[model samples]
Target chain A: MTGLLDAAFVLLILTTLVLLGSSRIRLGIRVLAVQGVVVGAAALLLPNHHVTLRVVVIVLIGTILDAVVFPILLLRALRTARVERETDPPVGYTASILIGVGLLTACLWGMKYGGITLPHEGANPLELPVAAYTVLAGLFLIVARNNALNQILGYLMLENGIFLAGLSTAMEVPLLIEMGILLDVFIMVMVMGVALFHISRTFDSIEVGGMTALTDWPDQEDVGK
Target chain B: MIAGLILIPLVAAGAAFAIRSHPVRRAMLVSVAAVHAALTARLWVDWPARPAPVLDGWLAVDAPGLLFLSTCSALFLAAAVYAVGYHAREDVGEPRRDIEEGGLFFRNEPEAVFAGCMLLFLGSMTGVSLSQHLGLLWVGVEATTLATAPLIYYHRHHRSLEATWKYLLICSVGLALAMIGNFALAASIPRAEAESGRINLVLGDLLANARALNPAWAQIAFVFFLVGYGTKMGLAPLHTWLPDAHSEAPSLVSALMSGALLNCAFLGVLRGHQVCTAAGFPGFSSELLIWFGLLSMAVAAVFILGQTDFKRMLAYSSVEHMGILALAVGCGAAYGMGLHALGHSLIKGSLFLTSGILLAAYQTKNVTKIHNLLADYPVTGLLWLAGFLAITGAPPFSLFLSEFTVGKTLLDADRPVAAAAYLVLLGVIFLGMASAVLPMVHGTGPVDHEPAGGQSAPPGYRPPLTMLVPPIVLAGAVLGLGLYLPVDVREVLRDAAAALSGGVSP
Candidate 1:
């Protein structure tokens, strides 16, 4: 079980790198799908003491959402917007990959020095470090990407990281409560999907940087100043 | 009965998507508001100034929850009423025709989506108030964000699209952090106890075991929760999405977002504060809130000074008032914060509604472009000017009483600096807002004036009666609350404040 967790963690890290290096929205999303599958596998492969029928059910639903439903929605949004590939992001692919490595090193360093240990031994040692990496990489993607689609992908990665952390803690939060939170995210992506369609329709592009038109910068009154 | 709050809105939303007629959808929206308000009133009359579960221990109306529910129900009804009247404009009544980019364009408004989302948004808010479980509360608040995201793009223009994108992205990240915060709060439970299967996210359970829970872990958790929920509440530094969202969203939607949603998000902060207070470190959470509150006020004051758009000015005022509510809550004046929220909602909701009226009549949101409001539309102008006064915490208004109580509480807490800063920021806001509003409300009409939007109404144009009356009704409610706090209300406020400040009950 521990070995499986380690392999899954490595897969998750490699997927994050793929997301950072990829320019095609389609490939980026496919990488995200694989990452989601890895997260689900980690849960299902949990040591017998930590596994439950409800956990299995949740991982199934989560897999469907992160892998199947979300990709279709993003693809539909793409078709509606009539675009296939993302423009070069604000952070170059090379730099973002380096940032990914930096994030992993920092996460491991923090765990070693920062001493944020659990009250007991965690389910897997790599869980915390992998979760931290995914979260930081997600934040980086959100900030460094120019495309709205990439931002959404980043958001999904953030959720993935948080999910990883929870499983590692083996916290006893109920299946029902977890489902309720997941439903909120489900609706959230759906709403953002609709907004993305609307945004692409209006601006004819989904570039986050193109949002400066509505700002209060050098207010209309202070334009000359 | 408690379940009805969540179910009714969901049902209405479904009906809204099914029913295609514009007027019926509008009626459905307002009817849900009415029923929701009636349900809230029943609960208010029955519930005491303490926490008690009514729905199998999953849902409860406590003091703070009741306070927010009342504010939510009232503003929702008022905003819906204003939406009904505002729909009579060309944008809603028929397909809009425009010669844009040198071509003829026509498009029908999505009335059903707008009306349905508003109903669902109200339900999400009510769910937040009635929920006793922290996970449920997070779901409820996040649902509110999702439900209202589409409503921000009601006009379906480039600017509206931009606003919706920013609103969704910034808030989603903020609330996701909040979810991580929830995880942190959960992790604070002792590992042995948690693994032994005694973990519960119910507010009561968490509060009961707070001292046994890890304080350091909870404190760190509380920080994440603050930033996450604080973004939704529009606290300074986390409030970048607010001004655009408020100013771009239709007036009625703006009213709900400012008047209700910010308070709903504040309820999350209050829950975290409750746990911290229980953990024997009341000062830790309270200090965090005070610094954030003060920073929010200063930021709001700076923005309000040079704000040109009336709607945007109202948005910044929301940030300022949200700052006031934070300060009030942090200083241990739960009663005052509750009243301040109620007073602020009524006054500000009316102000936003009247701003809608201004939009309809003057055809521009730009402050300088608006003139002779008092003469051109007497009912709207009086409500607008009165709302501005009431919102600025003038006497003979409920806002004054709440602001005074909040300030007095701050002084009593021996935070003279915070109290003084509160007063000073309020003064700055008033002067700045007065600089924009006074001229618009006082000036006589300028003949042959060119409208900023190129679609200004005739000088004597009158909006529908529905639009004018909601603000009038809201302004009156503000008056009633100022002149008298009913015995039941006073009990609720006192109890609610006591309850929020980590007391058991009366």
Candidate 2:
């Protein structure tokens, strides 16, 4: 079981990299769905945690939010916007992939050399670094993608990463907060979908870069200076 | 009573949604505001006789919480008055853009939704002020964002829509980071203590066990909490959404957002500082706070100088005052900081409300296109300049007294360099503010009185008395408190200050 957990953790991270590198929007969503399932399974595998009914329920809720509800929301937004691919990302695909790898490497290297350890003596080293990488990767997605749909995907990715880390590290995290966080994430994504539809309607596309009408430097002489 | 404070606004919000009549909904909004303000005042007066209870460690009202609660209610009540007046004028449908070529038409917003969300925002902010548990506090903070996002999109124009998107996405992201910070905080507790079932985010419990927390994780948690809440507070580099949100939202909403909402976020930061102080890491938090504070001030000064829109200018001014509030908190002069927060709120709230009047008169946000408020709308023009002066920390305003307290604290702490820098920043900000205000208030087109939507205002047109009174009342509060600090208000400040400094109010 421990071996499987280790493999699942690495696979979860591998899927995140795929999320970072993949240009097909559908493929990214599928990769994220797999990552979500793996994270849920891994939540059950955290060492020393009593697998109570509450934990099981939380895992179920989180899984549904991550793997099921989110992807549907993203797909609806994407279809409404009629965009199927993530193209002309702010950072190039190769560069974003490199950045993801760099973030993972930094987290691993910091864990080893930076004297970082959880307050709990037996806390597993694998979860924190992987979770950190996932977060950074999500941030990269949001920053690099100009499409509104893609940005929403990135935000969901970010929340998922936080959930994985929070659940694994903080045993005292009450069931109430876990449920609240899940609900907040779901509503946030739903709102983003509404906004994406509006964006598509208003700008004729869901491209975030098209939002140049409202800006600080409006005059031509110093528009961006 | 505490429950009533939270529930009243919420029930009003529900009723607001259910109501179909616009006047009825508007009346409900103001009535709720009045009741809230009254409750807060009663609570403030009765604090000593009947202290707030901590209910199962989930919710408690302490001195600082009451201070914040009162300020939120007071500022909100003033803004509520202005909102009713604002909608009255807005119903006249001023020209959406410049009064040329018949102008652009903005999409109509649902009045019920707007009214409902405003009340919901009030309830959520009240929740933030009273919440003692970290998770519940997080809920309130996030709810404030959710409630206020629609308020920002009230105009339903391209700009308001964009601002709404930014406000929602960015604040949600910031709050997600805060949740992770909370997780880190829980993780930092000693394993034995945590396992002993004393491992929650109840403010008192966390402070009690602060000594045993892992230093490394505690520092990590503090950083995330600061960055996360700081984003909401509109601190430098994290304030990207502020100007857009404030400028695009109705001026009344901007008033509440600046005067009332920012303080709630600042309370979250103060809670972060409280934990740091408890953990014997005051230096760490203080240094970061001061730096973020100065950086915010500097960034705001630059933007205010370049800013052309009057509402956006007020937004940047909000950023500057948030910085000063941060600086005061960092300086550990709890009394001074709380006072400064109050003063800034009174002055800033009035200023934003005044901005709404200016917008109504000129029908444009551009400072270049507006001139001679003294020549045109006399009351609003005079109030505009007065608010500008008051906000810039000029003498004869309450802001001067509070700002001075912070500067004295910095000097007493032997940070003369910081004190001097703070002063210099204030000067630069004043200059920047003056350049924008002088022309708007004193310069001479017989400034644009052609009300947008092709509504005509006669030459001697003045803003309605209801629209005029709220800001005048706020300005009086600012100037009055400057002249005389009542013993009652002073006592409240002292108790709240002590509470923030890790000493339970005596």
Candidate 3:
């Protein structure tokens, strides 16, 4: 069970990286959805001999929100905005992957220095490795993505990594906080959607670059009129 | 009583929203401000030590929380009064127009909704400052951001919309990161003690269990908390959204942001510092804060020097003062931090309010065009100029006394290097702000062309006694603090500072 969970973690990171390299917004969202599923499945594999029905319900809700609902919302927003190609990516694909590798290496170094050894008996050695990769991959998404929509994806990726970190002590967070977290993310996505719609209507583009025009030097015309 | 400070504005805001009559809505706002001020005054006089009501140890308030609550409540009352006059003038001067042909801009009606949201925003900020639990604090902070979003978009212009979007997106992301930090903090607590679900992440509990917290995880949490709250606090590197938001928002809202909102966020950092100190890592947190604070000062120096927009210049000045506040706290000077925080709150609040009046009078936010301000509006112009002087730490203002206190503390701590650095930064900021501000105050510039409609001022240009009173009162308070500190007030300041320093003798 632990081995499968560790493998799922690695898969999540790979999916995050793939999402970062993808120019198509739909594909990015799809990749994120897949990563979320892997995370949910990994959560299910945690050691829980005496899990209550309440816990089961919570895990189910969390998985459904992370895996199904969030991605659909992103997909809908992407389709509505018609933002298929990320023309002006913040960082190139190859450079981003390389940076991801460096980040993963640093994560391993950090974890090692902190002396965070897994205590769960029979857990695979790959647990730490997979965890490190997931976190760095999330960081990559955050740094490399230029579109505001994609940045949200990156944010979720980082969140997924943080969630994975808690697997060592799973079931610690209350169901309510977990729910609140999911609700917060949903609201954030909705607000971002509204902002994107407004931006597109005003600027004729949904690119994050459109925002750069906001801070332009004040024109005398504006002052005079 | 703390709950009342938050609830009164909230309930009044709802009432204002329901009432369509402009005059009634305006009256509601005034009454809410009056009631809030009265309650705050009561709290100030009593200085009651009511134990914070705990939700399973999720929230509580201590001394600092009470202090911030009082400060926020006081500022909110002042701004609420000012807003009534501001919106009334706006309504009389410029009626809503159909400007759809231009772009995605709409001339919003001057209805009660804006005033209502303004009060709600004020209430939410008060809630945040008084929150003892980390989770409640997070909710309060996030609520403030949401409440203020509508206020920023009040004008419904393309620029206002743009500013609102930036403010919302950046701050939402930052606050989300802070939430992640809160979770990490929960995760850092030891599980060996065996609670039912998760260990409650209250400040006091965290402080008590500091020794057992995972150091690495705690550090990660601090970083996120700092960045998240720091962004809201308008720290450098994360303050890109501040100037635009402050400049575009109504001047009354800008005053609240500069005067009140930034301090609320600073309280978040202070909470993190307390945790860090308890975790035996005071130096780490202090160093990080000082680094950001100094960086913010440097950023402000560059921007304020060449700033042409008067509002943006004031916004940058806010960044500079926030930097000084952080630096003073980081210096670990108990009295200095307490005095600086309170003094900055008063002076900066007055300055922003004065700036609002100037913006209304000149019908422009440009510094270059508005010259000989004293010639145009004597009382406001002189007050505006004095506000600038006071905010930049000139003598005969509360800020001067506070800055001097911080300087003395720095020197006494045997940190001449840090003291000198602070002095130099202060001097540079003063010079930069003076150069940008003095010209607008006294320089002779071309007269503004009257509107085609034959209005002498912009449609909403009336500066009523109500609009003028708050800043006058605040300015006098600043001057009074500078000239004399009452024995009781001095004692309170000492107590507050000592609280920050873990009850160390001042």
**Highest TM-score, which number?**
2
Tens digit of lDDT per residue, candidate 3, span B348-409? Answer: 77777888887677656767656666766778888888888888888988788778877887
Q: Model 3: which residue pairs collide?
A: B59-B133, B60-B132, B60-B133, B93-B459
Which 10-residue window in model 2 chain B sums to the lowest lDDT?
Answer: B93-102
TM-score of each: 0.93, 0.95, 0.89
C-alpha RMSD over true interface residues, model 3: 4.1
Residue ranges of candidate 1 with Cα displaced over 4 Å: A45-49, A79-85, A217-225, B49-55, B90-108, B444-458, B503-506
Q: Order the numbered candidates by TM-score, best leading.
A: 2, 1, 3
| Model 2 vs. true fold: TM | 0.95
Residue-level lDDT of model 2, residues A20-119, one tens digit each, is: 8888888888888888899889888877477989788888888887799878877777777787886788898899889999999999998878887766
What stretches of model 3 exceed 4 Å from their correct place?
A47-55, A114-143, A165-176, A179-183, A216-225, B51-58, B92-106, B109-112, B194-199, B446-461, B503-506
Q: DockQ of every model listed?
A: 0.47, 0.54, 0.33
Task: Please list the C-alpha lDDT of all candidates, in the order they appear.
Answer: 0.81, 0.82, 0.72
Roughly what TM-score does model 3 have, to 2 decimal places?
0.89
Off by over 4 Å in 2: A221-225, B50-54, B92-103, B445-461, B503-506
Candidate 2 lDDT (Cα, 0 to 1): 0.82
lDDT of 2 by residue, B414-474 (tens): 9988899999999999999999899777765343554464323324446787788999999
| Model 3 DockQ class | acceptable
Between candidates 2 and 3, the one scoring higher on TM-score is 2
Ranking by DockQ: 2, 1, 3
Global lDDT for candidate 3?
0.72
